[model samples]
Target: MQDLTLVMAQLDPLVGDIPGNAERAIETVREARIEHKADIVVLPELFLTGYPPEDLLLRASMEARLEAARQRMADKVARDVMVIVGYPGRRDGGYYNLAGVLYNGDWLGEYAKQVLPNYQVFDERRYFTPGNRPLVIEHRGARLGVLICEDLWEGRPVHQAREAGADILVTLNASPYHQNKPAERLALFAERAREVQRPLVYVNQIGGQDELVFDGGSLVVDAQGELCVRAPHWQVGLMPVGFTHADGHWVPQAGECEPLAEAEDSLYCALVTGLRDYVNKSGFKGVVLGLSGGIDSALSLAIAVDALGPDRVQAVMMPYHYTADISQEDAAEQARMLGVNYEVMPIVSMVEACNETLAESFAGTPQDTTEENLQSRCRGVLLMAISNKKGLMVLTTGNKSEMAVGYATLYGDMVGGYNALKDVYKTWVYRLAKWRNTQDPVIPERVISRPPSAELAANQQDSDSLPHYDTLDAILERYIEDDMSAEAIIAAGFSEEEVYRVVRLVDRSEYKRRQAPVGVRVTSRGFGRDRRYPIVNGWQPGE
Candidate 1:
């Protein structure tokens, strides 16, 4: 029987680091060949410059950089192994996403990605011209068909490869993470494998890129649509799968099949990976956030600690008159438990000083949210100062539910460089907190059970200005993610008043969200990139 060992290089490449990525590709090929006896190695889509290079693809030097990277790969990689890598190529004066095959220090063949995804965090069409041909190459008595990330999503590409006498289909991907995304990919690819009647090898990248996180769940399915191999998620490594040609078909040998993480576990890991990569890649000394002892901050602290370690995370509790004694106690207890540097800096004097300065301007104004917001602003100023002095990124702790209704103070509690829970709803915050406790028990029990409050004003609870989190999140998800109209949400058992109110608030809060720092996106439809609303518009809440 003819045998082939294929290795999937599930690696993380920093965006725009062409030379470094090329070196990494060369090293991975060498390692695969020496360790796994791999005859063929495949990397993720756009592995040279990382996925979603965005405007970097438009630079004049992009072609030169890519060519340099290609040359380096060719010169350094061993000829005994074949490497299939993804990079942007210019043909006919237009760019195309291409997967090039290299063997014996020469080009074997290349396949241009036929499909370009343009929706929901993908704008490939903006930079790439669609390709029209299929590429299938013969190696070691087996015909290998190559496809890129979006090409496998469509049908014509796979059909063309099969029609071209291909024995196995191989796909390179830089797919991002969202709730249940791994499952969605498996089901879709399993159907594709069965339709084409070929064993499919799928390779995906891992790590965080800006707001996107690519979970490296590289996998393989046999001709009958059976999963035979799966690499671990939220990890970077090289996975090997051996295939033998028998009975006129290439059959994949069983390999490591890592179990998929559960819902809460996956979501929590995504948050941690996103935060860790963002901090390390952005060159920050550490992260510091105002830990108000509420569920949101408590969970944010836990995530930061888990991501960058307690040594790299600092917590500052800025309490005011409205801040309760229990809040301070919980905050301190959690910080101590996590072994992070914790400090308490009261904000009462700072708020009074701000009021004294604005006394003349507010002489006729009755006490309102404006004064309560001052307390938040003072805490923000202190956090930013600490961040600037210590080179730490200020982590904002506002959840999606609060951000949807404008409950978060702009330039106040919203002051930060990154937010770990910006896309997570207030309800999920509690769920994640409880789930994390099962893992390590760092968050205090009272922190998870207590009613969430801003503590900006005396006797003020979040419920005072908004619906309960369960009701609020349900309405928000329907309107924001599902794109349901206000009338439709009302018809779905929500009260008409609450629907209209929440819808209006979401619409008017576009400006605040625009200014908010980018954060890890766990849901299919997050506030960034995916949801784009005009800050100045006359859109009303209606059907």
Candidate 2:
């Protein structure tokens, strides 16, 4: 057995909670040193004040508090076990997200993240100035180079450290969860390990920060490009590994590599973890959502139950005069099957009051979309009331399809603390609903088969306002995600009429999407920080 142990503390941290996060970091480092007898403990990036602090990074007090907290943590570390952790550091008037090497409770080395990812749910460039150099620290007869997050994604930083005689490349990250992220990270680790001809330790943060969720699927790879130690996904735990000199090369001798999960299952877990963290991290214990007896609510309910357990999820069904009898039955059945708290609060009285106020303005206007919107807004108000009275964070159930085409009510179903599926499309919502049923049939067959309705008007089908989900999602993927022109989409086997309609809807609905709540991102181009379109545009496509 090797004389040294490497411990990866896959810890869950709260954003901007410097003191609490600092305490956790100290306690974990102590555990690794004393209990596991780790020679070095590697923690995730921004471990002291948490990951993607967003605007909170702008505050000057945050930097001071983080430094003070790191010093406090250094006091608890043992002499033999060198600790590598992350914090935001200010040097020469420019702030950088950095990682520090603490040996015998002293500073060994500091590495600043060079590449600040400014795209897709990340705006590091706005708050942080990139660090141009790399850090290699000496400990336990080995020189390990440290990189923070995006530094490993590129070739320069890792290459520079290797040129400086680094025996191993270690990266601290707050990489967000998306479909197939584990495989993607592992593939990168293997390539980088081979590039540097040294073993790699990829330590990533776990927990949710607003719309982004960091899956703790950290791993270690030997120079031979073989995975040795892999941590679990959507979890917070410590995995201890040891390296040995074999054939005059470093190789992991302890811990085991776990097989990666399937794409859909992993996406499901990401949403569950994100929602759970967002709710619990914000100091709320449970969630409340408006159950419209639609695919979005059903999927949201299943995700909620899976994340926080069914006991922590509450569903309220608001039926109106235009609401169908089957919808009421379906929602109740789905709620009962999921073993969640359900309430059927009829919104007839509330709608009546709203209409009485708007009677003068609506006297001559034949009941149109405006009347339908009033009902949706009324439900939003009711849910907000319930959410306020009871300390439950309302999980909005609007899907990406509805959000894209302005098919959703702004102040109605869109009113919530967070949206679990704002990034998921109507088609994916149906697929997830089907997947949920496979675990156990929580949703009724009729609910999935029937046409989607808002229940704001009598027998109002979604098809009246938007195209079929399959066709809509295809066009959306092309125009919004792929960033293709209207003409390019038309060339990709889509009709002139359907393609232009989707493009138009996407362009026109910027106001509605602007008012939408933050959601867990499962797709490559979700509406969170990844996709942003202009609300006021003058360009019109000629398709």
Candidate 3:
């Protein structure tokens, strides 16, 4: 039996930082060769240009720069170990997302990704032409196949590699995280391994890019569809997978398999990872948010502190006339407990100034939600001003439930560079607050248990204008996430009146959602990329 050691470099690459990323990849390759003494090193998808790259892929200069970096890497790579690297390939007036083999200081072969995912956070169809064939290489007495992220998911590339006599598969991925995505991926990997009957090494990138977080749960699966090695999620490191050649096929040696975190832990980790990367990668000195004592803002403060630590997070309680003593006290208590830079900026004066300015125009109009929204706007101004002056990113605290409806004030509470709970439902906000406290009681118990309110007007609870959170979230899950119609939702045991009201609110709020700050997406469908609805569409459900 032949023994081969493979190094999986689970790294976090900044998007569009070609030279920096290239240097990092080269160092990782050298480490795999010199330290691990590995026969092969596999990097994540688009390691050179970073995953998604977005509009940067449109630049011809980016391709040229990447090619130059590739040659620089080729000159430095040792002949004893082979490196499989992912880069953007430009040939014959077409761009292809590619993975190439570098060995003996030369390019062995390149495999263009066959599947260009277009759904949910992926828009590769807008850029590259899908590859038609799979590329497998003969290396060190072993037949190895290379597949990019989406290629493995489509199954054709893996099957094609198997047909081409590949004994072992190494797939590079920059897969983004959602709750329980690791479990789903492992299940899919097991199925794919059984189909190909070859040991597969899966290498994924770890870090947050904008609203997306890639959890690096890199692993190896045996031909029998059993997981052999699993790296820790949300971590960046070099993990080793050993393969032994037996009966003309490679079998993976058993190794470490980190236990999957529970639902709450995984979701919280995703939030923290996504927030941390966005703040750090974007070069923000720190983060600032208006911490109302409500669950949404309170939970957001906890997440920001956890992500960036106390010194990097600023919590400002902008209280108004309607803001209760309990709200101020709880906000202060949580801020003190978490050790964040806390301040109290009462918005009463700001609100009064705005109200006075609008008094002439609103003389005939009676007080409504508009007056209440001004309070939120006052807080928004203070938070954004601090963000601008201190070079700290403003963290919007609105949750998915409020954002789904028109409950949040646009340019008011919605003002922020990022939202930690953008995809989290209101009910989940309470649950997360409670869960976070279990780690440590930073969040006040009253903050989690109190009836949620905006405190914008007198006795203005969330239920004053909308249905209870339990009913609202359930209806929203069916409508927004599951794509169920209002009639169908009502059939799912919801009241007909509540169903239509929630659906209408969700429909009308599309414009607001479009302008809302991007946040960590813990659910399958988030407001940002996963679900796209036309703001002016007249199509109503069950019409």
- lDDT to native, each model: 0.93, 0.84, 0.88
lDDT measured at residue 5 in model 3 versus the true structure, 0 to 100: 90
Quote model 2's TM-score.
0.95
The clash numbers for all candidates, in the given order, read 0, 0, 0
Report the C-alpha lDDT of model 3 over 252-304, residue by residue, as the tens digit: 89988998998888889889999999999889998999988888888898888
Q: 2 or 3: which has the higher TM-score? A: 3
Candidate 3 clashing pairs?
Answer: none
Model 1's lDDT to the true fold? 0.93
User: On a 0 to 100 scale, what is the lDDT of residue 144 in model 3?
Assistant: 92
Error of model 2, residue 17, in angstroms? 1.2
Root-mean-square deviation of each candidate, in angstroms? 0.8, 1.9, 1.2
Best first by lDDT, ranked: 1, 3, 2
Give per-residue CA lDDT, model 1, range 1-543, as digits (tens): 579999999999999999999999999999998899999999999999998799999999999999988988888998788899999989887789999999988887889999999999998999998989899988888899999988888878998999999999999999999999999999999999999899999999999999999999999999988999999999899999999988899999999999889899999999999999999999999999998888999999999998999999999999999899999999999999999999999988999999999999889889998998999899999999999999999999999998888888989999999999999999899889999999889999998887888887778888988999999999999999899999889989999999999999999999999999899889999988988889998878885
Identify the runs in model 3 with alpha carbons over 4 angstroms from their true place. none
User: What's the residue-level lDDT of 302 in candidate 2?
Assistant: 87
Worst 10 residues of 3 by lDDT: 534-543
TM-score of each: 0.99, 0.95, 0.98
- TM-score (C-alpha) between model 1 and the true structure: 0.99
